[model samples]
Target: MTIRFAAVSACALLTLAACNRTQEPVAPASAAATPPVESPAIPAADPNALTAEGLGPVRIGMTRADLVKLWGEDSQPNAVGGPDPETCDEFHPAKAPADVMVMIQNGVLTRITLTRGATIKTDRGFGVGDSAMAIKQAYGGAIVAQPHKYQDAPAEDLFAWPHGGATTYVTDPAARGVRYEIGGDGKVMKVHAGDPSIQQVEGCL
Candidate 1:
């Protein structure tokens, strides 16, 4: 025939160019589409940022942004009177002494009141059930106590005899002043001296 039909059309055009060079090279669907990578953003907390070693390690589920990252706002919400819970809100600290409250509620935190003389239980001078090493062996260092800041009670300090008379007749230790209320599980619910409702003693050690 015409040279076997032109050599069977040049071997069927070299088998369609070797089957399009073994196919499979078509990417470019936007180069196999790929675009997504971005994440970083989390910052917003400063309600009043507190401290006193951050209110001595507060506890109770903590939140209101962790009490504004440990107290910073200067705390102020107190509703009307006090005693907490109307949803709660009371945090005064102008230098301290609004009876030292800090209740919070929906935002978390429950209570904290280091008022009434600011804590000093007893350095041996006896009062809230006596026996601070037996009142430091019956008044050795000449006793003179300190610590005072009362509002609703609890958190006291005040010893006497810096030449004020009366060594320990049993009561009237100068008009008395030794409180130390620290509840919320931390312990020390109440010690007494004068007006924690007239001697509201409690455990100690």
Candidate 2:
């Protein structure tokens, strides 16, 4: 009888242990799973960014009347009449940025010039104060180095045919580009974006 009682007690203890183990909560299979990390969103292009196309609302091939309507009356006090005053002329829009100037050729907008005091950057990520090397790195083989008209070495015109258009001649009306005029200081003095007019040594040619 004593042996039977001991055997029954041992069986009861084992069953209780098994019940306790089973009663403990079992972890879900996904509990150890990690959530996926999302990548950061890319930044949008600046609206006022200068490009081969144009700057903000001003666009290449736009008519003078359209420009005037957008930025009020245009002013050209230093008109030299390169070939024809009505055709090759430059003007400042009253409501435009202080350092920006527009070139009109054949009665249409052709080039946009960013002079000193301009803080705007090109679509390629360059500005007035950037170095020639910076421009070169931004454009790589697309850059065409030309001798500066006035300054010595280190000062040169860095032209980039960003649109993959004409590389040899500036007469391709369909071609578009940007030019960085590096000064004797080895810093960009001016930036031009538009047609072959960007290759002009003088203001209007």
Candidate 3:
């Protein structure tokens, strides 16, 4: 009877242990792991942004040799009409963006011209197709209005003197500015930036 009682007690304890083991919580398989949140991507800088100093990697007062080195030897130099190369010439580098031209005056880069259909924009946020009113509004009192050399009425020129220096009288070679040529539609036809060459009506003409 003692042996049977001991056996019975051991059996009861074992059954209790089995029952407890079956009831143990498994932590619910750790609820499917959540994915981490991602941040928004940042925009890339514009390579064709026009500015008072220059456009993109090309700056005002850069030398032709510097441009040749920058654009590589394969980048051929294009002359602007009949202008003497010694006085002024335009270079359309093969590596440069389309519709963008650089004027090299006295072997130094003096102006950057953004022609029609160019996606380039001024530092002030003005572009080829922007309206004259938009440019005026963007520049406020910093810009001076002038008659277009070849156009009449709504068409005109907008000159910006960022440092309170006039392009006509300012002799400082470093004096930088921008010029917007407005078409008869009152929309910007072209954009010019850099030194006094920004005022060149005919562009190396």
Task: Go through the candidates in order and give each one's C-alpha lDDT.
Answer: 0.40, 0.86, 0.80
Query: Can you write out model 1's per-residue Cα lDDT over 22-71, one digit (the tens) per residue?
Result: 67788765555567876767554332222211234444336655665655
Residue pairs of candidate 2 with colliding backbone atoms: none
Q: Rank the candidates by lDDT, best first.
A: 2, 3, 1
Question: Which 10 consecutive positions of candidate 1 have the poorest summed lDDT?
Answer: 196-205
For residues 77-117, could you state the per-residue lDDT of candidate 3 as single tens digits?
44344368778777677777778888888888888888988
Task: State the lDDT of candidate 2 residue by residue for 1-205, as single tens digits.
Answer: 9999999999999999988885668876676767898899888899989998998888988998898888766655564546676768877788888888888887899999999999999987899999998778877888999889899988899888867555566778878999999999999999999998898878875
Which residue ranges in model 2 land beyond 4 Å of their true spot? 1-28, 31-34, 76-83
Candidate order by TM-score, highest to lowest? 2, 3, 1
* CA lDDT, candidate 1, residue 68: 59
TM-score, one value per model: 0.22, 0.79, 0.72
Model 3 TM-score?
A: 0.72
Q: Which of 2 and 3 is ahead in lDDT?
A: 2
Please identify model 1 stretches exceeding 4 Å from their true place.
Answer: 9-13, 16-20, 31-40, 44-56, 59-205
The number of the candidate with the highest lDDT is 2
